[model samples]
Target: MRKTCLDMVYELAKADDRIVFIGSDLGAGTLSEMQKNMPERFFMEGVSEANIIGMAAGLAMDGFIPYVNTISTFITRRCYEQIAIDLCLHNLPVKLIANGGGLVYAPLGPTHLAIEDIAIMRSLPNMNIVSPSDAEEMKRFMNQSKEIKGPVYIRLAKGGDEIVSDPKNGFKFGESILIKDVGEVLIVSSGITTKEAIYASEELSKEGIKAGVLHMHTIKPFDYKSIIKYSQKVKLIVSVEEHIKNNGLGSAIGDVLNDNCYHKMPKLIKLGIPDQFPDKYGTQEDLLKYYSLDSKSIYESVLGFIKSKGLKAA
Candidate 1:
């Protein structure tokens, strides 16, 4: 997904003169072709993440849309003030390509894990958050990103994920894609977790349970209308995400349900990392399993929730 995003940036730059690429201590060959062809527009800065945010803001102010690349933790946690003041405050057309979002950097421990990136970025007023499910979705999102009017936080997962998205369904920023039709239960997810949600839905189907999958690639400017429309048809709503349960995708859905579906709110179960930092270090899959965010665990959780609520299959 990261490779597809940067490749699209290079492709976008080739067509638009106003597009610029900015990297903070990335690989020498990150965008070798773009750097070789457009040296003037491509910039590879040092380890200063905050400085790069300011630079991107300046470039955006000068009518150039800058695409900044860096680790998710560094770009967000290390430069919160700069992102809030420089990029989001002015609502610039800067795309923040955050690599290794969520627990992708789990081997490096809690400091490198971007478990709170979504919550952090969502707090900023003008910042938009997008977590594509896979490379295909990333391509679709990047192809249309230029039209968005403000700073965008493009959350990326580890590459080589399952291609669960269908082109026929279409792609639109700030809109939720209904991967499966409405059923007795709905699984709402973003980023790589959407794949797990799909798997869980299939597993539930095998047991005479009816479950649907709703992929919310764009977190901010969330598809509230879809949530309201779907929630009315389901007995339970399960929200799964890679980030923390607080103020992440689950929280966003909760807020929407509270404001719009007060009287007829469905039972919601938020599956994500807890508020506390992880104590062990391992692969992304290991952490996900530990937190019960894996496909099997998600299936079990949803099954348990349904049994507890006495929701019958349709």
Candidate 2:
């Protein structure tokens, strides 16, 4: 996903003269072809993440769309003030490509984990957040970022994820895609967790419960319309994400449910990291399973949730 996202930046720069690329202490040969082609527009800065936001803001003021790439923690947690003041305050058109979102860098420990990134960024006005399921969807997000008026943060997962998103359907920044809507059990998910939701749908089908999957790739301008549609159709609604349960995708959906669904509203089972630092080092997949985010765990959790409500299985 990282390569695809950056390559699209390089690709976008080829066409639009106003497009520029800025890196915060990235490695050598990172977008070398882009630098070779458009050296003036490419900037490989050192470890100063906060300074880069001010610089990107300045460039944005100059009518150039800057794409800033760096580790998620450094760019967000470390540079929150600059992001809020420089870019977000002015509503600059800077695309922040945040790498290692969630526990992608689990081996690096808590300092690198971006578990609460969404919650923090969401608080800032004019800041838009998006998490694409895989590389294919990342391409779509990058393509649309050009038109976004304010600062947009694109959360990127580790590359080589399952291609659950179909390119034929394409991708819109603020729209939610409903992969399937069959039974009363609706599984709402975003980012790589959407892959698990897709799998859970199939597994639940065998159990006489035809679960549906609603993929919310864009989180900030959330598709409450889709959530409303499913809220009315399903008896049980389950939301999943790679971030913490609070102030993430689940919380956003919860707000929508509270405001819109009163009578006959489906029970919600929100699954995610339990708002604590990981206890051990492991791969991303291992960490997700440790948090009960694996497909089998999610399937079992949803089934248990359904039964807890005294709802009979189909």
Candidate 3:
């Protein structure tokens, strides 16, 4: 998804002179082509994330759509004040392209893990939070960000996921996509974790437990209607994400369920990173397994929860 977003951005920038790319010590060989094509537009500010964001905001004010690229943790956590005050307060159309979202940077330790970026960024006023499920979704998302009037935060994965959304359908702002049929269990998920949820659902189906999956590509301005309708049909409602339990997709959906007070509401389960920071360093897959966020772990958790409801213990 990050690669796709970068390609799309470079293509758009080449065609449109008003577009520029800004990087915070991430202008590796991956972006060499873009720099070669538009040297004046591409600037690599070494590790000064706050300055980069401020520069993007200023560029936005001048009618240039500045795309700021960096790791999820540094992009949001290190430059919160600049994003909130400079870009958001003035409603600048600065596109924040962040990589290593969720546990994508697990080997780099807790400081690099971006579990809290979504929760924190989504809370800011006039900040549009977008986490497209795949590269195709990201293409549509990047195009749509240009049309939007306020600041937009686009969280991209490390790539290598099969496209689940149709390009012809296009992406609508503040909307959710229903990927599969309705089932007894509804898995409402965002980002790459949505893929994990789908695999877990398929595994559960083989065991005679049909599961429905909803890919929540848009995190902020979530589709509450879809959530409510699905919540009524399923016996279990599980929200899976690559982010922390607090202020993430799970918490957002839970808020809607609680507010509506829908009768016979399905049991809500939040599957994500827990409160504590993991001390050990490993690969993204290792961290997911360690935190019980993998497909097998998710399957077991969901199955165990369902069994617990029936007073069955193995």
TM-scores for all candidates: the values are: 0.98, 0.97, 0.93
lDDT (0 to 1) per candidate: 0.92, 0.89, 0.84
Q: Which runs in model 1 stand beyond 4 Å of their true positions?
A: none
Order of candidates by lDDT, top first?
A: 1, 2, 3
Order of candidates by TM-score, top first? Answer: 1, 2, 3
Q: Candidate 3 on 1-314: residue-level lDDT in tens? A: 88899888898887788889998888467678888978999888888998998899888899999988899999988889999999989999899999999888877888888889999998998888888889988888877777778888898888787776777657898888777666778888888777888889889888777778888888877788898888888878888888889999999889889987467678889988887776778788888888788889888877887777773321
C-alpha root-mean-square deviation, each candidate: 0.9, 1.1, 2.6
> Which pairs clash in model 3?
none
Whole-model alpha-carbon lDDT for candidate 3: 0.84
lDDT of 1 by residue, 1-314 (tens): 98999999999999999999999988669999999999999999999999999999999999999999999999998889999999888999999999999989889998889999999999999999999999998999999999899999999998887798898988899999999876888999999999999999999999888889999999998899999999899888999999889999999999999999998999899999998999988899999999999999989988898788787766
| Cand. 2 Cα-lDDT | 0.89
Single out the weakest 10-residue window by summed lDDT for candidate 3. Answer: 305-314
User: Lowest summed-lDDT stretch of 10 residues in model 1?
Assistant: 305-314
Query: What is the C-alpha local distance difference test score of candidate 1?
Result: 0.92
lDDT, candidate 3, at 20? 92
Model 2: residue 97 alpha-carbon error in angstroms:
0.3
RMSD of 2: 1.1
lDDT of 2 by residue, 33-72 (tens): 9999899999999899989999999999999999999999
